[model samples]
Target: MRSVIDIVDLTAAEIDGLIATAEDIIANPAKYSEKCRGKKLATLFFEPSTRTRLSFEAAMYELGGNVLGFASADSSSATKGETVPDTVRVVGCYADIIAMRHPKEGAPLAASMYSPVPIINAGDGGHSHPTQTLADLLTIKREKGRLSDLTVGFCGDLKFGRTVHSLVKALLRYEGIKLVFISPDELRVPDYIRDELESAGADWLETASLEQAMPELDILYMTRVQKERFFNEADYIRLKDSYILTADKMALGKSDMCVLHPLPRVNEIPMEIDEDSRACYFKQVKNGKYMRMALILKLLEVE
Candidate 1:
């Protein structure tokens, strides 16, 4: 009966609960293997995605559930001009839960209004991506040992990075978290995010240099410049190579500083930095599946 449209939809306590559930699943995988037996999960991805879609399907399958749904708009009824609400209304009849990703902001919210089952917003344009934020939270908790009292630097594509926005909103609930925004003026964190940070009394700073912000960071979140989000090819080309995280750049950070990316990396993070103990992006992918599994169990009330 509940839907998650934004990271803020879940309270800090609920987030903690989900994280604990994910950690438990990680430690005792067999215990959760049959948790969703006989259940069905429908993934309605109206946009292109590999990680989010596959992660949701993988989570459901690992839970002993069946997965159904399309990977793109062309394969779905949307190509026939079927509305999001109508699509979910029909899918809700066939599935126990729905996970949706759309290029249009608020599409998932609109579907939530019509969905009979729980709706999980996988990613909706540049608006929000709650589940990815959950993954980030688990990664941060596991890597840094604690979420609070840390300086987290976000580098590249802040303006259109849904992951950064959602994670920032989630981090605001924790205490002593300093947010360092590293990007050019064109890609600075949106104004609404700034206003929320001020309202929450959270400390944050904006910088154009990643190396300058690197030394002080406990966690560095790198994001790729999304060509799909841009209307102009020229602008995309100009910012696409903005901040590349190479091995030399990693050396500027603390020995334990964790690096993360909501990936599909297009040269933002060079493979040379993968060997460093600080690179947690791959681990973040694995954590994403665990968190998603926890979310599926919670939303399905599978207890």
Candidate 2:
């Protein structure tokens, strides 16, 4: 009955364990080559995606498991008005496990409630993305050597970035974690997060300028501001380049600073900055596969 619906459901120790497992897999890939042999993972993605879909397929395939199911909702029975639970019930008959991504908030939770097979929430509507949080944790652990007592900055559209919200909640569990949010007023982190940080006693501050936060950040997490997240295109245009991470600006960051992006970045980060040694988004992505391998193994073991 165990399901991954939120980052908070996993404790700090469990998160660390997943990170360790990812590292272990990276070190010894052959040991896990046939870990999930003959198993099937059903990916029920309601929205279209290249990265998440590919990553999940890669993780399952590398573990000797077969991947089946729809890449987009239009191709699935869901387009015929199939309910989330109904879809899960049908897929459960075929899949040893299910990983779902949906546009509706709590859709995966609804799937988990009725699914006979284990369910993993791939992503949900502005809600939570726990697996991405796992990738972020693995990245943080790999680059910085630890998670707690560090300054982390979040830049760009915080209000709608599910990854940002999930990561903030995940970081709240650690001791002495401080957060710096840099964004225009309209795109700043929401009040719920502000309240969560305050209640958790985690030190946090807001800044309109990325420069002010760069010097203090041990980790800088960047996210894009979508035009849809705003009411008008003008606002998106005006602030689109406001948070751009350039080589010149990166010089202000701490010597050990690691830059991270959830990927599919659009102009928020300069291409030149990609060459920087501290840019860990690509490595972050590679770790995602390993972390997901550990997660697939663990969730399948939970019963």
Candidate 3:
């Protein structure tokens, strides 16, 4: 079996296929409801989570599959100092597939090396969240009608936003995609990301002005300034409100542009903007479940 430690682990064609499968699942719910009736999914989240964990569980349940595993390290063998490979080895014996989220970067990658079952990376520190990127791609494809030839603006905490990094990498593979990086200087997109974009000959621009960049975007992706990723309280405080998407900001964006957040949003996106037609963050969350369901099916080779 194959594991998805990074978005690049799946080719553009594979991504398209997953999006197509998700769209199919979305359109015909009953047809796929019992697709994985006998399967078991093991979620090994060594970090606290809400959306990602619940989404994976919900997805497995919707497929008629049973779910198991802890939501945090304290609840798992890791609290007793058991390592990732040791844990995955045990979990693999019980489950058909595994989805793991860890605080340490590449922990899932390391686990994948020894996993007897397919390993899905839920989130690995600030490294990558490939499944979330799948949700994002499916959302973009559904809302915008295509992933290519669109200007997408990513605002807020780019430096530590794993979703932003993963999505940016995935989007570069599409044709005619232009990226707008909107963040304060302290939280600009990482250099490696920029370097990758440059090497691929992708069009991208970095800016500190969210409002100025909004009008040009077909998709406006807002990310939270994660308090958990900060080393200094002062730095988090100063940058937390750097890019709030108020109604005024939404008005500046194109009328049909979709707004997406990987969610558990704090105050970056105002509740008032949620009523606007452009707000698709909640839809993104729903799409996430469908995408995960598609991914689990694809990885398990279940037709």
TM-scores of the models, in the order given = 0.99, 0.95, 0.98
Q: What is the lDDT of residue 17 in candidate 3?
A: 94
Question: Given candidate 3, what's the lDDT at residue 112?
Answer: 96
* Candidate 3, residue 249: how far the Cα is off, in Å: 1.3
> By TM-score, is 1 or 3 better?
1
Residue 237 CA displacement from its true place in model 2, Å: 3.9
- Better candidate by lDDT, 1 or 3: 1
Error of 1 at 148 (Å): 0.5
Could you tell me the C-alpha RMSD of candidate 1 in Å? Answer: 0.7
lDDT of 2 by residue, 1-303 (tens): 577888887888888888878888899998888989989999999987777778989999988899999999999988789899999999999998898999888899999999999899888877788898899989998898888998999998888788899999999998879899998888888788888988998899899988878899999999987664566788778877768898878999998999999888998887888888999999888888888889888888821
lDDT of model number 1? 0.94
Number of colliding residue pairs in each model: 0, 0, 0
lDDT (Cα, tens digit) per residue for candidate 1, span 193-279? 989999999899999999889899999999999999999999999989999998888889999999999998989988888888899
The total of clashing pairs for model 2 equals 0
Q: How far is candidate 2 from the true structure (C-alpha RMSD, Å)?
A: 1.7
Please report, as a residue range, the 10-residue window in candidate 3 with the lowest summed lDDT: 243-252
